[model samples]
Structures are given as structure tokens and as C-alpha cells.
Target: MSSGRIQQALLAWYGDNARDLPWRRSRDPYRVWLSEVMLQQTRVETVLPYYERWLERLPTVAALAAADEETVLRLWQGLGYYRRARNLHRAARAIVEERGGRWPASAAEWRQLPGVGRYTAGAIASITRGEPAAVVDGNVKRVLARLFLIDEPVDDAATLRRLWLLAESLVPAAAPGDFNQALMELGARICRPRRPRCDLCPLRPDCRGRRAGVAESLPRRRRRRPIPHRQEVAALVVRGGRYLLGRRPPGLLGGLWEFPGGPVAEGESPPQALARALVERLGIEVDVGPRLAAVDHAYSHLKVTVALYRCRLTGGELRPAYHTAARWLRRRQLGDLPLPRVTRKLARHLAA
Candidate 1:
């Protein structure tokens, strides 16, 4: 079958089975852009609430542009990969300042905006402006790779170029947005990464990988290195019902708040590390006490084991050195401030 026939089949399936998501209900570029950003590296269910709340708070591009960075970051607290939030804010400001609140008309123009890559620009332009731009996110990549039975490493530059070309060819002129979305939906719900329900797929008739009985393995993946693990320490410094929290420097989990601490250096005990971190990060000395909790958290490439120690300030004034800011907040007030997941868990432990 030709690509045109496959596009029609997918569109028919989409019209009948497309998810009634909030973003799908509107053609507003701002809403579409917001949903796309929030959905990056995050599950739909996890992003739903954040998307709703963000739209409610920053209803328009102008509002988002006017909002402060801290407020935006706080709204995006639990949604990891904070760089997305920062870029969204930057893009909003650019739109407001550069275009006087008018969104870019085409995918190419959208790509010129901050953090608006090819996939994102295509999504926004097609979904909102009816442009015939193709999006090749992970879901779309998997779908096309299997449908065409491509076996090259999905991350290879040549493979990516070939997939993008395939996606562009499959995008129909009419309702290109729906065609693109349908492709993604089919991949997400039917042609899943594992245990794909080929029986329910609209494109099953044309799937080369299905005929070869290798649909699940068509998109070859590169081997990943083992994630390195590190030990760290945090000081649970409290005084008069307030706990001390410090803002991270402008890197990694930048602009977020967390308990003051640092890595457990070589040959150093947790308590010793906590004491050292307190002096180095906060410009104060603390006498480390008993262990409060040992929390394990994993990032995309790093696994950390943080030993939380109860500590008392023993010398020097509380001053911010390495951190952006430092504050002592009561238990109830901590909820209002943005905190990392581990810090929130520690807060709950303290409250209990």
C-alpha cells in the first residue's frame, strides 16, 4: 500500500479513537506549546494536572512572559527536566517582545524560538496552524521504524534523517495535524514498545515488521552505560520550628531549593561530609548529629544515596556562599516553596 492509503487508515482510526485530552480541545498555539513542553520526558497522567494548573495560572503568552522565573519554576516543581520550563519562559518572553504576542506562522519560524526544536515546531505548526510539518518523537519514530521495518540504530544520524523523511512523506495535506497525532496515538496505545496489540492497529495490514514477526525490535537501540551511583549527605538544620533549605546553584537542578549538603568525599564519613558541606556551602559550621533518613533518588544518568543527618549550627553566621539563596522555613511554609522530591520526602518525615 502507498503512504497515502496508510495515512487515510490512521486518520480514520484517530477520528474514532483519539484521546479527549485538554490540549486536543483547542487550536490555541500557547496551549499546544505548553502541553508539548510539559509532556517531554513525562507521562501524560503526570503532566495533566501540571498542564491544567499552568494554563489556569498563565492563561496567555503575555501572562507567561510577564511571570517571574521563580513562579514558573515553582509551578514546574515536580515535573523534572526543569530546563524545559526555563526555555518555555524564555520563548514566551521572546514571542511577546519580538512578535508583539503573535505566534509564529510556520514550523520553520517556530524553530527559531528558544527550545523549539524540529519536533516541537512541527507539532505546534501542524496542530495549531494546519501546516504540513512532520513530527518524529520517540512514539512516531517507533511507529515508522516498525511499519517500514528499518533495523538501523534509531539514534544514528542517518537513521534519524531517513525516519524524518518517512514521516514527512506520510503526512497528508488535509488534516496533517490529525495524521501526525494519529501516528503518535497508534504508537502509544496500540503499537507500543512492548507487547504491541497488532490486532488493534489500523496500520497492521501494511506493517512490514509485523510480517517479519519482529515488530517489537525493529527500532534497534544503542547500548547504554551503567548509571553511576554516588553517596551524599544533607544537614537537617532546624531552629525554632524552622528547617534550613538552600537554593541550588545555576546548574543541574538549578534554581530549586533543597537541604544543604554535598557529596560524601573519599574516605569521609556521612557526618563528616555533612559538617564539611555546611561550612563550604553555607559558610557556617554544624555539629552533625544522628541520622534522620537515608533517601535514594535517581536522575537520568546518576543514582544518589543521600544520608540526612540532624545537625546543630555550632559557629559562624548563616550566610549563603555557593547557593543562590538560603532560608529557614517552618514545616507548613515549606509546602508553598518549590522543593525537590527527596526534600519533600524529608519534610514529611520531619512533620511526622
Candidate 2:
């Protein structure tokens, strides 16, 4: 079968077996946009609950546009890669103010929206508008690389460009949304990253890699270098019953709450790092004690091993330098506060 026949077979298979994801219930641009943002670097199972809650809170783009940053951040508490939340908020506001509260229709127009990259624009445009744009996310990348026997790693810009061209060529006409979703579904379920279900795939007969018995090796990845590691000391400052938590400022994991902490310099003890960080961020003297809970958080770029300390706030009022504001809340009130999962995981130990 030709590549076009392969796509047609896959599309037919998808029409019968495509997952009934919550995001597919409606073609509303806002709902689809929200799911796409939340689903980036996140699993569908995890994004589902968050998506439902987010929609319940800010059902409309204008509502999200009008909501306070704190409320938005709180709603986005456990979802990491927080720039997605900020970008969504910024995009919502942009649509409200500039586009008269309606999202743009074309991929070119959607690309101008905050945080909407080419892939995201393509996803939104194709899903919502039936545009002939294909999205080459990780799943689709695996599917394409394995299907066409491409040896280039997905992360290489040149390889990715070629993959996109191939994707554009294969995307079926008239139902780009279904086709893109089917490709992604195939990748997520049958064409998995670790183990593919070639026996069950409709395109198995036509797959070049499968014919060569190299399906697993076609999308060869460069050997992964160990993720760079950094250590940090966090001061878990508590006053009365409440503990001090800072709202991370906009940029990366912006808007999420975190314990006061930063990079631990060379030869610096955890206590020393804790004290220096408190002074720099809050202008307060804190007595760092024994370790409370240590967590290793992995980001796309690097990894951080954080050692948290229970600190006594000796002096100085709140003068948050790198955060929007600081707050102290009871252990139970912590539930109401949206916090980083790593920080929230630490809270149980701190509350002990």
C-alpha cells in the first residue's frame, strides 16, 4: 500500500476505535485549546480531571480572561510546566481584547496567540477548523518515524522539519482533526514509545520498518546524556499555624506556589543556602534546622534535588523579591492553596 493508503487505513481504523476522550466531546475552540495546553507534556488521564475542573472554573475564554492571576494559578496548581497556564491566560485575554472574545480561525492567526507554537497552532486549527495541518507531537513522531523508517531522532530540528513535511503529505483531506487525532491515538496506544502493537495495527502490512523487521530501530535516538543536576535548600517558614509559601513569578513555572529556595552554591551547606536564600528573597533571618523532606524534581532542561528545612522566622516583614506575594496558612488551609506537586508532597512531611 502507498503512504496515502496507509493513512486511509489508519483513519478507518481510527473512526472505529478512536478513543472517546473528553476533549473530543465538543469542537469548541476554547475547550480544545485548553485541553491541548494541559495535555502538553502531560498524560491524558492526568489532564482529564484537571481539564474538567478548569472548565468548571473558567468555562469561557472571557471568564478566564477576567479572572485574577491568583485564582488562575490556584486552578492550575498541580499541573507543572506552568508557563502553559500563563500563556493560556495571556492568550485568553488577547482573544477577549483584540479578537473580540473569539479565537482566530486560521493556523497563522492562532500562531500569534501567546504560547501557541507551530504544533499547537496546527493542532488547534486542524481540530477546530478542519484545516489540513498535521501535528507532529511525540506520539505522531514515533508513528511517522516507524512507518516511513526515518532514522533521524525526533528532537533534531532538521529531522523534525522533514517529519512535518511528511506529516503534511499524509494528513487526509476534509477530516484533518480526526486524522491527526487518529495518528496520535495510534501512537499513544498501538504505536507506543516503548513497545508497539504492530500485530494489531492496520498499517502493519504497509509499514516499511515492519517489512524490514526494524520497526523498533527506525526512530533511533541519540544516547541520552545524564540530566544536569543541582542541589537546593528550602526554608519551610511557618508562622503560627500557617507556613510561608511564595507565588512563583511569570516566566517558567510561573504562578505556582513554592517553598523559599534557590540554587545551592558550591561548598555551601544546606543551612547556609537556606539562610542566604531567605535573606535575599524575604529579608528575614531564619534558623534552618534538620531536613524535613527531600525531593528530586525533574524538568525538561535539568533536575533539582531539594532539601527542605523547617525554619524559625526570626525577624523582618514580608518583602518578596522574586514572587508576587507571600502567605502563611494552616496545614489544612494548604489544601485550598494551589502548590507545586513537589512542594505539596513535602507538605505532608512538614505537617507531621
Candidate 3:
């Protein structure tokens, strides 16, 4: 079957089965851009409430550009990948200042923005600007890999390049956005990683993987390296009904507030690590007390276990050494500040 016929079948299926997501209801570029950014490495169910709440708070590109960094980060608290929020904020400002309040008219132009990569740019352009651009996200990759029966590792650069070429060829000129979205929707709903619903797939007739009896196994991926684990300690310093929190320096979870702490050295106990961290980081001596709680969290490359310890300030003046800033915040006020997921969990444990 020709690409055109496949497109027709897919589009027809899509018109009947596409999920009515909030972003799909409008062609507004800002909303589409926001959704694209949020949807990266995140699930629809997880993003729904965050999307609704984000739009409510920052209704427009202008609003997002004008909002303070802390405010934006606070709104994006649980969305992991803090860099995405920062880049989105920067891109909004650039769109307003450099483009005179108008979104870029083409995918190429959108790619020049801070966080807009090829896939994101293509999605925004095709979906909102009626541009015939190809978007190959994870869903589309799975769908295409199975459709063509490509067995190369999907993460390989050459394999991905070939996939992109095929995607570009298959995207219909008319209603390109709908066509691209249809491909993604099909993958998300029918061409899923496990137990794909090949019977319900419109492209099943032409699917090479299905005919070859390997639809579920095409697009093989390389094994990931074992994630390294580390143990860390945090000092829960309470003074005058307020808990002390320190701002992380500019990097990974940058600018987020958390309890003062650092990784435990080899053979160092949690309490000793906390006590030493206080002396070196805050220039204060603390008598580390009983362990409060232990929280386990994982990042893309690292797994960490954080042990929270109640502490008393034994002596010395408080001074910020490693942190950008340090503050004593009430439990209620902690909600307004940006916090990493593990820190938030620690806060809840303390509150309970």
C-alpha cells in the first residue's frame, strides 16, 4: 500500500478514535507548545492536572514570560526535570521580546528557541501553524518501527535518522497536523509496547512486523547501565517554629529549596555526615539527633536514599557557603517554594 492510502486509513481511524485531550481542542500555539514540553518523558494521566493548573496560572506566553522564576518553579514542583521548566520560561521570554509577541511561523524558527528541539518544533508547527512537518516522538517511533519491521536499536543515530526520513515521507501535506497526531494516537492507544492491539490498528494490514510475527519486538533497544546508588543525609533544623531550608546552587535541581545536607562519605554515618555538612556548609555546629525518616528517589542517572535527621544548633553563626541562600520557613510556607520530590516527601513525613 502507498503512503497516501496508509495516511487515509489512519486519519479515518483517528477522526473516530482520537482522545479529546485539552491541548487537542485548540490550535493555540502557546497551549500546544506547553503541552508538548510537558508531555516529554511524562504520561497523559500524570500531565492532565498539571496542564490544567499550569494554564490556569500562566494563561499566555506573556504571563509565563512575566512570572518570576520561583513562581514558575513552584507551579512546576512535582514535574521532575527542572530544566524543562527553566527552558520553557526562557523560551517564553524570548518569544515575547525577540519575536514581538508572535510565535515563530515555522518549525525551523521554533527550533531556535531555548527548549524547542526538532520534534517539539515540528509538533508545534504542524499542529498549530498548518505546516507540513514530521514529528517522531517515542509513540511515533514505535508505530513506524513496527509498521516497517525495522529491527535496529531505536536509539541508534542512523536508525533514528532513517525513521525520521520515513516519517517525513508519510506525513500528508493537507491536514498534516491531524495526520501526525493520528500516528501518535495510534501508537499510544493501539501500537503500545506490550500486548499491542493489532486487530484494532488501521495500519495492521500493511504492518510488516505483524506479518513477520514480531510486531511487539521490533525497535529493539540497548540495555541500560545499572543506576548507581548513594546515601545522603539532611538536617531538619527547626528554630522558632520555622524549618531551615537551603537553596540549591545553579545545577541539577537548581534554585529549589531543601533541607541542608550532602552525600555521606565512605563509612560516615548519617548523623556524622549531617553534623559535618552543617559545619562546612552553614558554618554552624549542630548536634545531630535521631533519624526522622528515609526517602528513596531516582533521577535519570542516579538513585539516592535521603535520611532526614532532627538536629539542634549547638553553636556558631549561620552563614551560607554552598547554597545560594538559606532561610527558615514555616511548614505552610514551604508549599509556596519550589522543592524537589524527595524534599517534598521529607516535608510530608515531618508534618505527619
Give each prediction's root-mean-square deviation over alpha carbons.
1.3, 1.8, 1.5
Highest lDDT scorer:
3
By descending TM-score, how would the candidates be arranged?
1, 3, 2
lDDT of 3 by residue, 303-347 (tens): 999999999988988898988889999999988899998898899
Off by over 4 Å in 3: none
As for candidate 1, its clashing pairs are: none
lDDT of 3 at 346: 92
lDDT of 2 at 30: 93
- Runs with alpha carbons beyond 4 Å of true place in candidate 1: none
Question: What are the models' TM-scores?
Answer: 0.96, 0.94, 0.96
TM-score of 1: 0.96
Residues 1-352 of candidate 2: C-alpha lDDT, one tens digit per residue: 5767877898899989988888899999999999998988889988988899999999999899999877887888777777788888888988999878877979999999878888888999999999998798888888888888888777888999999998898887778988899999998899887678899999888788888888876577777888899998787787777788887777757777778888899998889988988888877888887788898888777888889898998887789987777888777777776687778767768644
- Looking at model 1, report the run of 10 residues with the lowest lDDT sum: 343-352
**Model 3 residue 41 CA deviation in Å:** 0.8
- Write one digit per residue (lDDT tens) for candidate 1, span 1-352: 7988898899999999999999999999999999988987688899999999998999999999999988899999999988888899999999999888888989999999877899999998999988999999999889988999999989999999999999998898889899889988998899999999999998999999999999987678888999999998888898997889999986778888999999998999888888888888899888999898888889888999988888988897888998889999887888777788878776666744
